[model samples]
Target: MRASLTPTDAPLRARLLALALAVAVLAAVAVVATVRAADRAAEKDRAQPGEPAAHAGEVTLRQPGRLLFRNLAWGPQRDRVSAVPLTATSGPRTSAPRDCLRFHAAAGTGVCLRATGGVVPGHEAVLLDARLRPVRAFPVPGTPTRARVSPSGRLVAWTVFVSGDSYAGGAFSTRTAVYDTRGGTLHSDLERFAVLKDGRRHRAADHNFWGVTFAADDSRFYATLATGGRTYLVAGDLASRTMRTLRENVECPSLSPDGTRVAFKKRVAGASADAPWRLHVLDLRTGRESALAERRSVDDQALWLDDRTLLYALPGDFGADLWSTPTAGGGAPRMAVRSAASPAVTG
Candidate 1:
């Protein structure tokens, strides 16, 4: 026989039980909501475009305009180059056929050509007009490696490799030549430039030249020499007939349109061979240097859109693409062009 409970006590016990059950349900709902919110945040982060990630170097904006690019495709058996245009709003304009190797533009007109077929064993260079039409094709008495036009479109400079064999291991040498478009003659003789070597063995018979560019005034030009662990930037004065070392251990020197500065890529100290190179800007007047944003992989084929912006090729998983950054500094890179390489800009 149990004693009868008071009605007030009984109601109080019932209320406490109900409150505990409600609290447990509320806690469970809160935990689920918190987890869902966290997942949404992570998804948003990955979905955002132009999110800054580890980069190889700083990007600089040299000019504000559309960028026109020339892409080169090389496989185990074949090689070709093409011309394509890109703007901020539209991705890629139109791509020419794969055979086009070199190009130049003026007043909304451009020209390019298929750099095969006409190359001679000792000489290789083919000139084109503004409509992708082949103008004059000739050999430079050596294996032509690089060719570029003056800013005024009146002059052209090129480097050729004089070698005993066809492939990379062969003994090689270089010759520099300049041609006048208006005069219809070669300005400079096929001058012997440099001799390259493999390893400690000076393949006295081998030489290689690359990365050629003209000065702002087109009175002078520059190129690079690679021999084993040593690299050099050679500035040649056409009038003086002399070459000077502008920098050492540097490759791919790109001159600004104004000729006030030069941008290049190089290996940093303690950097692994697999580590990507960084972009650097050099003041021609002061000889001062500054590193751009750093990246994890190599950057290549840097070109100035203007003095303030730099457009370069950044390699991706599928292929290489074009990217732009401000020269003044700060801000992640933006995609200026996709599926592109060897970018050049015209104002």
Candidate 2:
């Protein structure tokens, strides 16, 4: 009872339906192609080593392998030390290859020595050298906590922590020891300056002393003392055997390469371990203090490329990365290297 459509009208209706279906098909195909391209790009990014993105400003470290070095001002090019095996484990489970000793053109050459013999809780430490090989291996005593060489390459200092049981109860103490490479002897003058909590002279291995570093001339050194329910930075006179408090409530102090400043990390009150700490710089000459940079997470291992440039390790998802910032306070942090920690700037 309905009239039939003409042939021309019928063709037009069919063409419109066909076009709509074609458009829908094309859209689906485009979406699939886009998803595949994205997946490929992600794979490529992962395959690449180091940081996925490059940082602009300062210098770029694109060197391969486990090590990377970028010259900030240029003094002496770093001397590449031969890769030495550190572990006794055999087969495929062996420890990863690490630099036992490294020498910066500015910091001089040093041989990294592993603990040997009947040393309790053996640990590793580095001994500075004026030439290629070390003059002598410095004794770190107890368990080695931290080690560093003087800027002038005259002295090496480290922290040792000993834990044992006492008559009263369980006890623990930290000691700071320094070795004179030229003299080939360990100095005990500062070790005796440490005192017990009861105002008594500390005997061998009594109190805890950490974060030891020597000045340029090796005549003076600084270390952190945690005792009497407080932490303090103490500067020791090697010649006079006198100890003076430099700062309080600070830990992990790193002396600047020029020996004019000290950088340290501090914890804030009412803050948890998840909260970040502040990095502070103290002027040795004027006793003035200033905050160098504020980080969102914990930061340690600070080293000076020069008097004005500072380098430190930042925590990352996989590991730590090296970042550099200006000590004068300008510009954001730029990536110096990736997947490395304990950055000791050479040259």
Candidate 3:
């Protein structure tokens, strides 16, 4: 015979029963949520309907009239350096076997920044030849944010965020390196370069530099210098190992092909806290500035598709899609390449 519990003990027993039932219900819901998440993750590995066709093949950065970018499509070829028609980016593409987080190429030379996996994850920068074959690899201390090569393809530069992987909390530190492919000279940290802020010697422990854009001369370059809550467009000399501040609020400066202006991200007033940058161009000779027609906040470095058109990446359905806008600031922004990032024009 089952024994009947006392009044107080019966009430405690009821509470215990209710607690167990609630726990079981919560566990069931959690299991369903986890299963749904796993299914969604699995779906990303399969090619969805209406997606662009991509195949693993030889990708050469030496091919002119091709646009090279980090593929963000969902499939086996995802995250590889892919090549597509410069004008018709919506068409099919050829993906290379090499994977990179950021990539840039010029004059048949490519710099691929990739993540390394082990017990401890890390990153590295790989120099690639015209055939997209790695020539050498350099260990990077942190997450790669930018990679660039000189027009002559003799110099390669990269930037890594040292403190954290992103600018999520408005505080981060970066390390920029420049490698001379021809001379085998490497300046692993640009902070060691002498600073000439305001035409006088400037010394600060808080200084940081990134987003290097080389001049056609290959001896001169421009990059962003940050210190004391302000950012500057600093012109640098590789021969002299010095940098001089030019203007303010310029970040990720990409020099124009003509060497007359720079396309950069400017933090403007009346912008949302999270999305705080607008694409702008600064005339290197005249110091005149003009904002582009891209009203959306662009976080990536702007690349000059030509003298008048600018290309950049924005958040998209797959990962990021490249968009184009007129540099003179008139028409609406147009999507240039879908599911691609880190655009580099091959020549």
On TM-score, the leading prediction is 3
Per-model TM values vs. the true structure = 0.61, 0.60, 0.88
Off by over 4 Å in 2: 1-98, 101-107, 111-121, 126-135, 138-143, 161-173, 188-190, 194-206, 274-276, 297-299
lDDT (CA) for every model shown?
A: 0.55, 0.54, 0.91
Best of the candidates, lDDT: 3
Which stretch of 10 consecutive residues in model 1 shows the poorest summed lDDT? Answer: 52-61
After superposing all C-alphas onto the true structure, candidate 3 shows an RMSD in angstroms of 4.7
Tens-place lDDT per residue, model 1, 36-144, is 9988666533422432121112111122354545542222111123333334423323333333344433323333323344354233455655434456765555544
**What lDDT would candidate 1 get against the real structure?**
0.55
Error of 3 at 307 (Å): 0.6
- Model 2: per-residue Cα lDDT over 8-57, one tens digit each: 99889999999999999999999999999988666533523433232222
The full ranking of all candidates by lDDT, starting with the best, is 3, 1, 2
